[model samples]
Target chain A: MSGIRVSLRGKSFPDASGNGTRQVLGELGFVAERGEFVAILGPSGCGKTTLLNLIAGLDAAYEGEIALDAAAGNAAPDIGYVFQNPRLLPWRTVFENVCLVLNAPAGATALVEKFLAEAGLTEFRDAYPEKLSLGQRRRVAIVRAFAIAPDLLLMDEPFVSLDGPTAERLRAMLLEIWNACPTTVLFVTHDLDEAIALADRVLVLSESPASIVADVPIAVPRQERMAPAVLEEFRKRLRQPEKV
Target chain B: MFHLHAIWPRLASFFLFLLLWQLGAMALESRLLPLPEAVFAVLRDGFQSGEIPHHIGITLGRVAASFVLAMAIGSAIGIAMGRSRLLDRLFDAWLVLFLNVPALVVILLAYVWFGLIEAAAILAVAVNKIPNVAVTLREGSRALDRDYLEMAHSFRLGSLRTFRHVVLPQLSPYFLASARSGLALIWKIVLVVELLGRSDGVGFQLHLYFQLFDVASILAYTLAFVAVVLVIEAVCFRPLDRRALRWRR
Candidate 1:
């Protein structure tokens, strides 16, 4: 347990959006073995996104310490963030949006092509976001975030607006890509089924100024995880009322 | 592309106006208010005599020079003010002062400063135009989305790339809008400035006609200048506006 890989321990100051300094993560302790998927589930105002921000080093105004094991490599984990909204630049075409991540690398066109193909957006390489449907735009955002091949990927409820079927489809695609790249993914979602469908462990959060109330591990394998009956059990566990 | 069916009523009203003016000429029986046919006759005669083109060329040259100067300087200052609140605040009082003060006053001031030179006329027109462009673009820049800018930062795009790929595209509509109105207004002011200060151009020509109380010649010159304004709207502003808005459905 002590040899576990990535972990963070800190209390972050609430943001300036009148998000008061409430103990969101509350000396939050978690450890992920290498290549693990963690689903963080919480209510709407819960600071689930804030926790991911801390992990991504985007928010440093915090009280406690957070560290990743850097002993094995010279560089800390490369981080990629997919915001709640698609947030694709309206002026840029889909290919240009993905290729924006290829600053240092060569052959930008080829990399853009690869990701467009992977994201099933090759037909839209030149299409603007205004032309794309909601689902297509979300896919472009995901591909852009993942195209850089980051060591850690943080997603903040990236499919809130999609239909359930489309969300499920994307979840499967995301799992497929995650398996290939094998990066550490800290996923945040309001949907319990989504959390259970993708994660090795589901961390449930309390309401605003939130704290992690439970971290439930999934014993099932990825292939059998999304089964209707298996998801029902996970849903039942998450539905229980909160304790003080 | 010019829709006359929608404006047929206005056309009818204008024809009625011409008929009324002809009737008024007949009633008053005064040479100062010449009949519409007489003004048309004067226009035709002036065109045949070739003096019309010379006067038109001079007026066109002045308008073109002033319009270009206004667009260049107006757009630059407007964009700068829009991008920086400090600059906007610093220049706000001066801009308001100019926007409120009469164009005639500015032209008079230019005449005093520069003595009827082409530069004086151009400067007068440009000064009138800059505040308008700056105000429109300032609103545009203020309303720019921070989300797009944040995305640019994450991409690590260079300044030129970011501007070309992100900022300018968003700002293109604002630029087109400002340029169109600014062009129209500066040219109108150019004519006024010419009438007051310069000895050449359409305004000066109109003043020469006015002195003789030659209503036919005055109406002829006015119709010619109005036609030029129509040509600018058709040939330049409309097509450019369409191209800039191509991204929209």
Candidate 2:
């Protein structure tokens, strides 16, 4: 089991002019249960990505305790992160990109092939990132993140700008993989529909210097989340509360 | 792959350059400027006598030694300085100073301090090239995409693998840029070192030919060395460049 607990007092970034500091996140604390999918939904430029980065232990200048515990007794949970962009090494092939993170290559070949096929990227397994289309590249990024079977998977708007149909398909694929692995996923997105559709719990956040505005739970079953009626109900109930 | 259509323009360019040189020589009609054919004939004779071949071999060895030394040490220091703020602040001033230092002064000092040995000569050439390589690679390291590095770190791809897989590939274009210019700069510096101190090499032969006012031999030696450099660029560097950058396509 993997879980993330963060209690941050405040976080600020130096302004572009370099003479002043702008506070980005003000008192924020949340606990993600083991094997839970928590979607952090906020408006654009609401310090959503910064929150994910801090939870992923990428930024250490914040004032608070962030604890990641693996119930399996590992020292620290092995994290798998998917950025908004693919960020693949252009010089490396798709197979090589996944293999580099495996660390133990002897038994990883079969696992890599399985993940590629699962993501429907087996045909593009040897292709470089530049050779793939934007949608295909995002698929590869998801595949790379899932192939490692990470204890904690943090995704920062992995499907932000993709066309709706492709994003829908990718979301289905992500659910299939996460269902099989059951890792703790902290997904950050601006789309409330996406958050409700994918996350077991949705943490609604305000604009910059962000703090939680609501802690939403997806009461509908997973299979029914995409149904028009259920989504309509969620939109009316969730949006009316925050007027977002 | 070898398109005949692409070659004609290149061949014509070469022909135009030679025609210009021939016209200039004829217009001058001086002992200083030899005809292209006369220089070629001198080159043939020099090879027949084995003197030019021996000197060319010595110069090639010196150039290779200095090139390897500079690339290794410079890349190491460059990556270190690029990654660490402390290291960069400590060595940045030294790097700038070395970059501005004259190659002539460096060669003179090396010879004086190290007694004009072969080691001193090679050291002088490498010292001249290191700061340039370091500067180029430092920019490459600085421009490394943080997203890819973050992916590596999140996946727990240890530091060694991160450097090999993430850092090195991004640094390659910069590495190649420095190497191409480094070879050219080292080629010029090595000759100067040999001319100033060494009893052998093409530079020494050129010095000897100067005493006799044999401008034809000097021109011939220059043409042969240029051909060598061109051959090396075509046979080694071009292929390596294409392979390294094949992914860009």
Candidate 3:
């Protein structure tokens, strides 16, 4: 699967009050090569979400140009976003919610069933979202994001607010899907270890009115990504007082 | 099978109401307040002659017509107002004015302008209900979840799909609320419109009986119409309400 090249230059949003504007992204520019997974890590209240919003085209009230250049053979690069919450339509059953994004065709039923099974939600496919546990809802959201076969998938802390085991399980599920159907993923999170474990490259941002402080690449092999020594070394390098 | 345990309380309350009315009639000892037995006899006579059913049918048709019209037009206007600031500002004053104006005035004005036609009667009833439905749905639209809408956008769900999946579910409760309240209000207003001008309806029958001091027949018509309204509430609305809100369980 081909990827997308996202370029943003000087994105800014004005404060709600008539005060001066807040510079969320200051001449920020990055590109995710085809089929690469990039994690954007920043402190809380930073413009991590704002950056994702710009790329996802959710927030258009920003300065500078944000462009998505798709690779050849892909006409329009579809984007799938997983918000901090699952954001499922509570009235719809799990399967129906996934079907909401798919262009209606007879083949959609099989596609939905395949994704539901992949996410361990086959048994709960007919259950309403309100009846599912939070982790299950997040799993459904992940399945929904992948169902559309997006070229650029954006996730904003999809595992946030879950218990430790649930979050870990969801992360593992995400990796399994990513491995199966490779796509350009732009994941936003505040967790350092999560960024290290999941992303090919970690881009750290400064505090509010953020800009890229460091672009750290995890050179360790994929199998050893979570090794204690490797994780300790990266943590030491990222936490240097001079980086901020 | 019907449950006697569930129905006994309602039956007992109805009987108690009838006993109180009978006592009041005995105390007045006047023709103005007929005894329950006399009213029931008139009701039986009206049913045998088929006059009461025909008039009841006409009034119900008006109620249904007005209810559907008001909900459709009001929901459209309410959603428009909620989505657009310009429309909301333009219609805010007009909505408040219509809401406060007496239903009697609107009905009389409609009859005067439209000349006592079915269109005028239905329009009058619908006008009385539109502002209320519009107000309730406007709030619903305003409170719609932006997060879900954002999800739709990110997934590239088109306008129609977004509305069906994201907008309608959130608005269903408001729709149901407006429908319930609108039914109650429209039936009452339709009766007023019928009484003021129409030739055949429960309202017209009551007007005719009023001139002759036929207290028993008037009470009988009132009782019959109330029973029809109660049946609609139980048979049509209650089941639909349960189905629409089944997701809550």
Candidate 4:
């Protein structure tokens, strides 16, 4: 199967209030040859969300052209985004919320069930957003995004609010889902441990006027992902500040 | 369902207030303020002779017709205004004008234009109710989440299907709230219209009572209307609201 790629050309980052515009990313480029999971780690308010928004088409007030690699006359690659918050419509039951994403391509019940079960939300499918605990709501959001089966999945700090155990479980679940679908994922997080746990390559960003400071590729084998020694090594490497 | 045990204190308070009213009537020896027992007797006789039912049914029918007409037109206009910036801006002045106009003045205008027919009375009440429903629903439609709508668009949901599955469900609470307030306002306006126009409904009966200085009969008709309003609250509005917001609990 042919590979899918995306490029952002000439996108200027907005300046901080009253500060002069500084180039954040200059013709910043990266290519995922085939199926690759890339994690973008950055300091708070360093344009991580801005980058994701530009990619998601949620904001078009930017100077850039983003291109998709797809056959002529074919549909553009579908993108599913998991926001920092669950952002579930509080009024809908979990089942109804997931079913909403399926309105485009018919017969998406199986996809909803698959992701719900993967995310351990099978029993809570009928629950509303307010009734579920925080972790459960986060899981619902994750599964809802995954259910869409977008060619590109963008997750923005999806587990930032969860407890350690829940975050670990979700990170494992995310990897499993990624393995199952092999969708190109752009996972953005502030936690180094989370980046190490899931991403095939970790892209670190500068403090502000953010640019890719380092792109650290994962060296550990998938089989030894959960092993304690491998994780310790990953943690140590993430702590060392890169040459600015 | 009655929760009688929970409301016993309030019921006792009501009885005490009535007792005080009865005592005051006896002390004053006035025909204008009848004793509670005398009003109860008048209510019993009115109900037994079916006068209460006849008046109540006429009042209820008028209110129902006007309320239904108002809700239909108001909701349609509200959805349009909420959905379209152009329509909202174009009709905003008209909506503001009608909302501020006094109900009695509108009824008077209807009387002059339509000559005190049942249609005029109903139209007057409907005119009073329409702006309320429209304004509430317009705000509701505006407050709907754009993300949910985008999700719907991406799915390519048909307009009717989107309305049923997404838009309607979100707007249900607003609709229910509008219904409750609109019903109360419509009933009150309908009574006034009936009193000023043709000779039927509780309002006309009360007007007749006023001519004869029959305070007891006026209170009886008022109690009957109050009972019907209570019945509507219990049987219609509360149940529908509970069902619409069932997801909350």
Q: Specify the highest-DockQ model's number.
A: 3
User: For candidate 2, lDDT tens digit of each residue in A143-232?
Assistant: 888777788899999998999999999999999989987899999998979998999999888778998878888977888997998898
Residue-level lDDT of model 3, residues A156-200, one tens digit each, is 999989999999989999999999988889999989898988999
Off by over 4 Å in 3: A71-74, A241-243, B1-3
Instruction: Give per-residue CA lDDT, model 1, range A1-244, as digits (tens).
Output: 0112333444656457775754665546677655778888888877787787666665677766556554255355556678888888776678777776666546666766876788888898898788998888888888887777666677899889899899988888888777776777778999878888789998888886666678799879978876889878878787663544
The deviation in Å at residue B69 for candidate 3 is 1.1
Using Cα atoms with residue i matched to residue i, what is each candidate's TM-score against the true structure?
A: 0.80, 0.94, 0.96, 0.84
Q: Provide the TM-score, chain A, model 4.
A: 0.85
Docking class of 1: acceptable
Among all windows of 10 consecutive residues in model 3 chain A, the one with the lowest summed lDDT is A1-10
**Winner on lDDT (2 vs 4):** 2
Q: Candidate 1 — which pairs collide?
A: none
Model 3 clash pairs are: none
Per-candidate DockQ values are: 0.35, 0.75, 0.79, 0.28
Residue B230 of model 2, lDDT score: 89
TM-score of chain A of each: 0.86, 0.96, 0.93, 0.85
Q: If the candidates were sorted by their lDDT against the true structure, best first, what order would they fall in?
A: 2, 3, 4, 1
Under the 3 Å rule for N, CA and C atoms, how many clashes does model 1 have?
0
Q: State the DockQ, from 0 to 1, for candidate 1.
A: 0.35
For candidate 1, give the lDDT of residue B106: 83
- Candidate 4 per-residue lDDT over residues B130-149, each given as its tens digit: 99899999999998887767
